[model samples]
Target: MQYRMLSDQRKRWVDCLRGFCMMAILLFHTEIYYTGTSIIGYNLYVSDALYLFFMLSGYLLYKKAGMIDIKYKLKSVLRNLLWPYFIFTSVMAVPKALAHGERVDNAWALVQNVVTGQASWFIAALIVAEIFFVVALRLCRGNLFALGSVCVLSFCCSALLALNGNLVTFWQFGNALQAMLFLFLGYVFHRYEHKLVVDVWPTV
Candidate 1:
């Protein structure tokens, strides 16, 4: 009963955190659009909120990691993420192409952007990251060291890509590589939550 209560409390806090991150992101974008600069001056801090979102997603999914079916999960990911991405990108493409037809070259180029995930890049990156997480978890088979190694490798690859001017954005895979590290870290945190001390503030 006590364990159940603790779990519930943690969930509530996690939801609050997610909401806070969402607001932060909205504010950051709004500020940039209106003023051409962040009020905080350091714009990256709000960008980190996106990483927190990735981590929170992984943390929540940790419980289901063991039960993941690769085929089913892949289908679900595609249906949920890819389908929406396509629909929205297609909707936006009509206007963009109409507005700048001369610069667009051809319809195939727009299709290529959708395929490469340059259309709505974050969703593409997330799709890849989630798939990578599922595969890594299956391969690691509950081995923390193996999982950590995979996360580290992903981070290194992402860093290298950035250093080399990001030669490939296919499916936004380079961004996904970086997201994998935060996702794994979130999963680790949740997996060991009972061993860690987390405090709730009533005043806030």
Candidate 2:
């Protein structure tokens, strides 16, 4: 009974954290849209909230990471992320194009944009990152060293891409690479949360 109460308290705190991050992101975007600059001038800090959001997502899904069926995971990703991305992108394409005074002449262009995550790039990047994380988990098979190595490699690649200004916008592969780091961090945190807390503060 005590364990159950602690679990519920943890969940409540997690939800609160998520809500705070969401509000921060919304405010950041709102300021950008209206002011053309971060009036508060804390752009980087607020932007980091998105990574935190990714971490939370990975933390929540940590239990499922142990599943052996890669195909099942991929299918879930497609159904949850890819389908919504395509449907919403398709629906909004015409209006978005018109708003920018762009001609919607090429159906292929629209299709390409959707495929490349031109509509909601976050979702697209998430799809890629989640797939990579899942595959890496399967290969690592609970080996922290292997997983850490993969995360380091991903971070380096993403940093290089950013430095070279080679980030594929809309496709957001670079963003996903960095996002993987946070996701992995979240997974590891969940896996060792109690030990970490104890190490940080011996007395709870």
Candidate 3:
């Protein structure tokens, strides 16, 4: 396959999509935080939007992850998750624990909160998913396409199992699989993004 760099305009579009995704994420968090005040669709719509964001997140961060060397990419991945995790969990856990007169066990669990850090189990989920996906990628020797599809199906099945137990319904996925997907999508975009020129832009 031949490789060609993206034009200025298309890069701008990816940047715009990224910025929009960030805002959507923030809005979801904000609404979830304020959901106690009877804000309409605060929990529902915002949560749903966050799911879409997760589903598409893999499609988004692909390029940056893919273009870099694999070892470096793996390091980048760990660094991204670990540092903020350590810092935030350290910063927030003790005070909350003190307020309630009981420590939530450890800094490890606090990092798992979906609402504050990412969610109740998002960090754990992301780390698990990332590890599996990266291992698959390494074994397959860059068969990211095959490995990514498998990761998607595997995570979705886990979601199904979570549902069967009467746990959180729908929206069971997160950025782990998305990281792989977004990486592949970046490769695809870098490959065929020229096809994206269209008649008009649509708004939500």
Candidate 2 lDDT over residue span 6-87, tens digit each: 6887787678888888888788768876776777656466767778888987787587336547798789988998888888
| TM-score for candidate 1, residues paired by index | 0.82
Error at 71, model 2, angstroms: 2.3
The lDDT ranking, best first, is 1, 2, 3
User: In order, what is each prediction's RMSD in angstroms?
Assistant: 3.3, 3.6, 6.1
Better of 1 and 2 by TM-score: 1
User: Where does model 3 exceed 4 Å of error?
Assistant: 1-11, 32-38, 42-45, 48-57, 60-68, 94-120, 166-191, 198-204
Off by over 4 Å in 2: 64-68, 94-110, 196-204
**Estimated TM-score for each candidate:** 0.82, 0.81, 0.59
lDDT of 3: 0.52
Q: Which has the greatest TM-score?
A: 1
Q: Name the best candidate (by lDDT).
A: 1
- Tens digit of lDDT per residue, candidate 1, span 74-146? 8988898788988999888756565544356588988887777988777888888999998998898878899
Tens-digit lDDT string for candidate 3 (1-204): 123233444556556765776676677656645663435555555555444444444444444444335576568667987566656656767665665466676766555553343432455445445555556666666666676577667657655655677333222244354444444454454445457653233332
Kindly report which residue pairs in candidate 2 clash with one another.
none
